[model samples]
Target chain A: MFLALDVGGANIKASVFKADDAFALRSAKLHYPLWIRGVDGLPKAIEQAVALLGCDLKGASGVALTMTAELSDVFRDKKEGVDKVLRKAEEALGSFKVVTNDGSLLDPDEAVDRYMDVAAANWWCVGWLASLFERDCLVVDVGSTTTTITPVVEGKVAAKGLNDVEKMALGEIVYVGALRTPISSVASIVPVNGLWCRTSSEYFANVGDVNLVLGLLREEEYDVATPDGRGKSVEECHERLSRVVCGDRNMLRPLQTRLVARFVYEKVVEKVCEGVLQVLSRLASEGRYPEVGFAAGLGDFIALDAVERAGLRGVLLRDLLGRDNSIALTSASLALYLAYKTGVDVGRWISSLR
Target chain B: MFLALDVGGANIKASVFKADDAFALRSAKLHYPLWIRGVDGLPKAIEQAVALLGCDLKGASGVALTMTAELSDVFRDKKEGVDKVLRKAEEALGSFKVVTNDGSLLDPDEAVDRYMDVAAANWWCVGWLASLFERDCLVVDVGSTTTTITPVVEGKVAAKGLNDVEKMALGEIVYVGALRTPISSVASIVPVNGLWCRTSSEYFANVGDVNLVLGLLREEEYDVATPDGRGKSVEECHERLSRVVCGDRNMLRPLQTRLVARFVYEKVVEKVCEGVLQVLSRLASEGRYPEVGFAAGLGDFIALDAVERAGLRGVLLRDLLGRDNSIALTSASLALYLAYKTGVDVGRWISSLR
Candidate 1:
């Protein structure tokens, strides 16, 4: 079995899988907000995730790793963050091969030396996974903390930007996400009783509360902590969402809070659609128009909404790789790719699963 | 001697003063960041601030408390937050008189029962102080975490909104601040080399970096923790500012970073101006337009800029009461007001300082 890990700033996902004749894959995810936990919390978090996945550390043939956690501010810079995360992984589960933006796996030392390439390369892994099914496509994976939109052409990753800055410039990355994005970051003013009121940029509420209030996300699925440190109940979400406009349950009517939620939902969708349109225009300029759009991750519905709005035929990656598997797509895809590279007939295994 | 405390979500400010034959006041501020440290850290943080001010807590007759910390997310709701913060204050200092939005002081038990009134009443104390100086004027106090625009009309506080929600609706509050405001909340797209680029919504940079890069704030004045867990040097500020667009020192040139900083600075100033204008229009509609504007607190320069844009005569509160005193204006003003109320003949002392 190969253990694949996708360490992000707000979440850490692990997938234990084998790519032989009899295929087996088990994945687990843990919300370990690196910004809150800091780099010091990585080892224990990684170990806890491995235990949750019920994977034997000694039995794993190799470890495949990709991380976006280095982007967290706990470290002074990305290089230090990447080095520290790698050291933690080694301390917990031994040596690992880190996937870089160039779609190559390098040893821990080499990855640390070229930290920028390895920092947020989880997108490349998911894109490679999408390329396996479709030669020309766009992959929109909206996870808990960020969204990655990647393009694949002629059976290879053809993204315009490799680094985060360039990717953001080209609309290959939209920083807004499903869960932890502050509501004020999405909307400066929200309408209440026909009056547009400015929002409190005080981290009073986040998108997760919006989704829960709008019935887009279930209470159990609200994995991250609520903005007010309140419960994730629908009623609690209303109170939290009300605070986006600096109100609470006693001050705002139920309908007003719902209005705020719907407004934020539309705004988030609009932001993702804007990114999709930007990417599509870039592709059109390059003379490559992808018709097939793949939506994956915890926020596949959000990605699908954007894909449909962008005038592309939306395909839910969850349909092919169960809902839970798709949420852990980056790590699972990395493991699958590594197995395929190691002479496993993963094509048959993947086809059987689908 | 009375010890005054202005406990905010991101900062804890204390002022030690006397309401006797001769008036004396000494103020000190500490950036406790209540959200990060949580309510458990409050007592210690308050004690440290008292120690910093070189005051004898036991010798003080009473503690005058006004807080915006109840709006922090560490507690489930404002009531719990207010109760906990009050408990911490009592534990750190002693019996206290909590300031309420009605511009009155109440004992601790009564304050807890009427938590909503006591939650964020610091603005009222500051407005009362402004009223003491000018019968008809708008007071713009831009602190590290939030801004309050209060109108003192006919020698009394005439703010249209009491709670934060209502205040936000009436433009009495602008949530952006000088130090801790996330850059993403200020500007979604920043101009880089004449091209508008979408910025990453990550907390990779904040307005403190923008102010530092623009020379509006010195290293020592940055005060709050940096977004990247880096130093307060100008070069470090440049690097953090660049990351607003997901770039770093290696990716962006010095000129590009400076341009980004300038753009963010302008956006912040514009946001504050919007709030000021909103409040001004409301005052004009009421047939009680304030001709003069008093700019105070840590972001006095920002407030002054906004006052100018709104066509109001700007007066820096710092010039009236030295720079350090003005930065801790909410607490200092509260102490001054309490002293005046106790028959200190503070009017003479204030004129002497001027």
Candidate 2:
């Protein structure tokens, strides 16, 4: 049997397979979060890894790990963060062969910093989708506080200045989002009935909270931050988010909440699409819309915008990275499949994800 | 015989008295910033309260406007950053007025709709100094990325915040210093020589370029942007700031050049001061210092560390705000003697600079 895992600072996900049927590995992935201490996380992860393994220590033959954990900027000290996780992994999973970039099962120090770009998988997955589907495309990864876009050509990311924060017309880093973004960072005043109305910077903070007020977040499927792994009660989220604008939940109608979410999303979407278009247009000015790949946890959002904004067809990764049994939603998740297929050792830097 | 003035989006200050007098009739008060954009500031200022006149505006005659230019943020829009010196002061400044507790001059339509405890200042001068100084003090406001500190006592700035960036270690509002705070925002990898190592989040950015980097600035010097009147020098200012980062200033610093500036002055100073001293143990901590007055312009920096960190002996202000006519330095002219003294309308808000 063989197992492949994807770890992030916030969650760990894994997929399993039988050696003889490696191609038939389960399509789903398991996720768990790592507790980042004053700096220690490795030891705790080993315990979690054991529990994740489920079977006896000798049951599994090979394990592969692909990670985006190291790319996470949540830690105050990225180096120490990586050290703490790697130390714990070494102490506990001492017997298993570790995996990382450079196609080596070596010490954490020896691993290539393949996952240095926390958001790299989002673009890579988009690349995979384009190569598999044979289409031109763009990818937008709308995470908590920032949104990123990537364009692909001939199975490679063609965009220069991959991190495009310029082009305010494209909506540079709105600093507003569904989670983690403080509302005060949003507009001090919002457009109301075609006129700009001043709003208190203090009164509204965190678009996530605002989205909750508008009833846009589904309790069952969108409970990304709620405890117990269960989503927030829709009403509870709404009540809290409404406070961003006013003390009354009635301050926002269902449509208003969605508009706020859409506004935030559009601000980011405009930026991402503008970035992709900038790259595509620059290239197309020379000839044609080169075949572009697409990937991201929020691939669907990217795909739709790719169609409307860039007038390009996006290839769905499930068509390429998917086997019949798999169900995944992220480019990072898709990277596991890409890495498995290409043997790129995507998890090569798992030890560094503290 | 001198006058002191402190102007802001929501407030305006004017003080009058002779050098030999004890501020006989301090009467400058708060008013709308847009008012000056449309009319002669001096004439309009007096007209607003011609009926409520305290000290004679026409009688005292020579007026100095130390403004926190209300509504200048819009002109700065982070684009079209500047224009031919506003033929008329541009429209309403930014989305909101930066403010202190219990102080505001704008009307309901122009104010924020919500309340926030984001820890802001209407102006980064007086309160910043009051946070540190103890004895009567005179403050020399040589702002920009560079600021100079001169102590005053027995009617002067008793203590100085110097680089308000450092003063943050004292007790004051955050020190995301004036003049765009440079973009590199890089901090030194200090403590390397000691048993421990401490890394600052400050990237290589300067305070002057933050608002103008993306051309998102305007040349309205009479606002929250700067404490002085040099607006057209942004290109030169940016060039100077870009050169000091000590590396490829052309390339984005490894850390966020923009966001990190916030940490350098605001977060870093706060954290360091809190970490270094639990009680007031610094030089000015002795003898319950009285008189917590301060100067405007770069007074914010001096106020940063002096007030809370060392414990003020007392606060002092100068009849003059900067070292303009002093033997200290040139091009380092401090905007001396704000008119917000005398516990009147302007004084009420001056006390609330933090």
Q: Give the winner by TM-score.
A: 1
Regions of model 1 farther than 4 Å from truth = B1-354
Query: TM-scores of the models, in the given order?
Result: 0.52, 0.39
What digit string (tens of lDDT, one per residue) describes model 2 on residues B69-182? 433453343112112111122231112122222223222233223122101222333323333333343233323332333433443332333322334433222323345343
Query: Recovered native contacts in candidate 2, as a fraction?
Result: 0.00
lDDT, model 2, position A336: 42
lDDT (Cα, 0-100) at B312 in candidate 1:
73
Superpose all Cα atoms of candidate 1 onto the true structure and report the RMSD in Å to 1 decimal: 21.7
Score chain A of each prediction against the true chain A by TM-score and list the results.
0.97, 0.64
> What TM-score would chain B receive for each of the candidates shown?
0.97, 0.31
> On residues B233-285, what C-alpha lDDT tens digit does candidate 1 reach at each position?
99998888777778778777765665566557666766776676667655543
- Where does candidate 1 clash, by residue pair? none
Clashes of 2: 117
What is residue A352's positional error in candidate 1, in angstroms?
3.4
How good is the docking of model 2, as DockQ? 0.01
